[model samples]
Target chain A: MKKWSLITLVGADQAGIVAQVTQILAADDCELGETSMVRMGGSFSMMLRVRHDDMDLGALLKGICESLNLHLHVDEDVASNCEETDPDVNITVYGADRSGIVAEVTAILADAGLNIIDLETAVAGTADKPIYIMTIEGQALQGVDALTEAAKKISKGIELNIVPIQTLRA
Target chain B: MTVLDILQYPDERLKQSSKTVEIFDQTLKDFVTDLEETRLAGPGAVGIAAPQVGCARRLVIVDVSQLKKPVDNHGYLLLINPEITKWQGMEKGREGCLSVPDYTGNVIRAESIRIRFQNIEGEWIEFDSGGYEARAIQHELDHLDGMLFLDRLVSRRSDLFTRKTYKK
Candidate 1:
């Protein structure tokens, strides 16, 4: 049986954060899989899945945190057997930065029987007139029409481009 | 002219290399009409290939004139046994295919190209195409050799984007 663990780390944005963390993982002879890292605001965040040889995970976390000046959280019981389906579509929302954008959109998707697989958002421009861009990729549970109508109900001043995913591959 | 059914992805027929057209008969002409009708029927479709419609012939149709984006393009083109003779400059362009409708990806293609092809009348014609027109043509031509934008993704993790929905 494979022992899979999930780990999350966050730290103030700086150069070489990725190198330092990766070097530590390499030193431990651990296998890293399914990872995502991003810079949000003034901080950097990372989430990763790993398989280690029954090492002291608590001590490893402390060493990583102290050396990289970051915080670490780990869950040892993550199930690795679940299979994920590809998303049915990709929704991109662009408008003025404001609260509730993700909440409202995710609520609509959830209600329409859509499962969000991945999401990324960023705010650009200025503090006074920031541009909020959100991309949500997920699988549709029902049909395409239901999701389109739900997306259409979003507030004005926001531009939504809905593209139907080709379920076929070449 | 009737709109032909487009072959979706994972169809073995789409992966087969198309045969070059040697005879310009009425059957070929009729196929072109159906191809044009099918392309027009697709939402925002500017070009299409024969393999997309399950035909293994070297044929494609392109017209970028009506798009909202102002592009340096020739009005309408019907290419038969088309071949790119020369190409220059490289740039990344976002593209979605009618056959591969669900995803869009950034593909690196030549910014400008010189191509030779047979028109509807079976006359070999050559032209210098650039910008969006060039990109569209390259995408359709890739189908002749059984290639999709997914196969040309600059980076599978970063360049590929799932399309939301196409609204009229």
Candidate 2:
């Protein structure tokens, strides 16, 4: 059995967060395969994906965050499970950039009982001309038309577009 | 009608810039035939480029009237040594590639576009289009630049993939 690893960082904008996180991540015999980091106003946020054959990474990450005086939380990854079932689908949300877009949209998805397998989100444009783009790959729950209905709700704040996973046939 | 053998990822020819045609010669005619034939043979086919058939040249053919899309467009359009001059509107779409088989990605594109291209007779012509027609134009033009739909993929989230369906 393979264990899942997640590394999350949050703290005042500073230099040592990565140096410290990598130290703990390395001890887990984990390999860092994916990462993204950014500075938002006065704080720094980072997300990373590592692989380990151990137990929950959430508890380990929480202790690290506490010792560093930063706020952090981690949860079990869901995308890996979804990938095992259907391997094709794309869902995205786009709109005016704003705070809590991820929280709000993720909440909506969870409430609808949809399983979010993989998600990538970013704020493009400028501070004065901001645009938000959030992409989630998942399957709709029973009695849910994930592509159209979810898009309509997300669009109330941001434009939404949904399409089936792409395939090339010759 | 010849169905194109889809080129796959990391094929060096796919990354090399395409060569521009100096004239609408015999080679150009052959490309049109191949492109058109490939378009017809594909399942839910709409358009194809010279490079998709393994020829790196400035030629492509498109016919989208059969698919469900935005507007009424020409039945079939064959273009040579083409170039786009202007466009309007902004849209993000999910586009797949014959070369990068079995995967789809998000692509931001123009809503309408003005373009110029030569016919098989060497007569150059220009036109304007919107909706699905514009998408076809952009798709074909990207082929001329040696670009596949994969380059425009914003993220891996939209990657719809299938088990290896086509071989070189």
Candidate 3:
């Protein structure tokens, strides 16, 4: 079996940050897998999975972090073996931008015994009068009716839509 | 005719490039019927391709009429040897494939398209489509070339999502 590592880096955004990090990993004989990078606020954060035959990855990655002046975290890849549940319900929420929308909505989901598989939130419109939109894909631990009932208890101002997602192979 | 089983990923056959329908005979028409049956049987499935059912032919069926809000659609479309002549406006939307069960991804496709294809009757047809209809057409068209939505993902890791469960 191939050994794997999950690596993350966070630091100030700069040009050539990805290129430098990838170059270092390539030089270390590590095969890169899936990578995700996003800029939040002003800082850039990246998460990627890698596989390697050598065991000196931790020390080598730490050295690269030092040279790049970025915070680094590495962990053995354990997620591949674990069973992951797919979300059965698709939830969309959109309304005025407010502080507690996510908290409230997530709380409802948690209370319903649902697991969030994928979520994306954005604030659009304008800063002064912004519109917040959140799309959540969640697995139902209980039932669709239970989830729907839980969503109904949320505050009235926000608009919410809960639909069962049909998974097809084509 | 009956609904054919949807071939899953790693089946090897799904990766094979489909050939254009050279002879539109009774066999081809029968296979197209089976393809339509399979598409209708699959829950919430709006379109299907020939390669998904172990047939490597340039054929696809798309019908957005059942959707809640199908925009700029031609109701039901049976495309053979479909080709996109012009595309406009890039948009990213979530899509899942019947062959790749338990996963969905954000695929960037043209927001609107001017496409040309032959109908089931073997006559050439051209039309314009936009929004969800266009997205569905593109998704099915990719199958004819041995491509899945996963291959067109905007960002592999971020755009790809594992489905957690099924309701219907």
- Expressed as tens digits, the lDDT of each residue in A1-170 for candidate 2 is 55555567678887787888778878877677657777676788888767776576766667768777777666455243312333244556667888878887777666666677678776788879899887777666632354355444553666555554432222
DockQ, Cα level, model 1? 0.11
**Candidates in order, interface RMSD in Å:** 8.6, 13.0, 8.4
Query: For model 2, what is the C-alpha lDDT against the true structure?
Result: 0.67
Clashes of each: 8, 2, 12
lDDT of 1 by residue, A99-134 (tens): 988888789768988788778887878978999888
Native contacts present in each candidate (fraction): 0.15, 0.10, 0.15
Question: In Å, what is the interface RMSD of model 2?
Answer: 13.0
Model 3 regions more than 4 Å off: A82-85, A94-98, A122-133, A143-145, B1-22, B26-48, B51-56, B61-94, B98-103, B107-138, B145-147, B151-168
Candidate 3 residue-wise lDDT, B1-168, digit = tens: 798999989888887799988887788888888889899888678899999999898989988777654345698899999999999987656678888876676677787899899876789999999877888999999988888887787752343232332221
Greater TM-score among 2 and 3 belongs to: 3
Q: Estimate how well candidate 3 is docked, as a DockQ score.
A: 0.17
Candidates ranked by lDDT: 1, 3, 2
**Model 3, position A111: C-alpha lDDT score:** 95
On lDDT, the stronger of 1 and 2 is: 1
The parts of candidate 2 lying over 4 Å away from their true place are A1-9, A13-43, A51-170, B22-30, B37-45, B101-106, B148-168
Which candidate tops lDDT?
1
- Best by TM-score, which number? 3
User: Mind giving the per-residue lDDT tens digits that candidate 2 earns over B1-168?
Assistant: 456676666877777667877876786677677678776776665777787777887877777666543356876787777888998877655577667655555676687888898888988999887766678779778877877777776655433332222211
Report the Cα lDDT for residue A82, model 1. 49
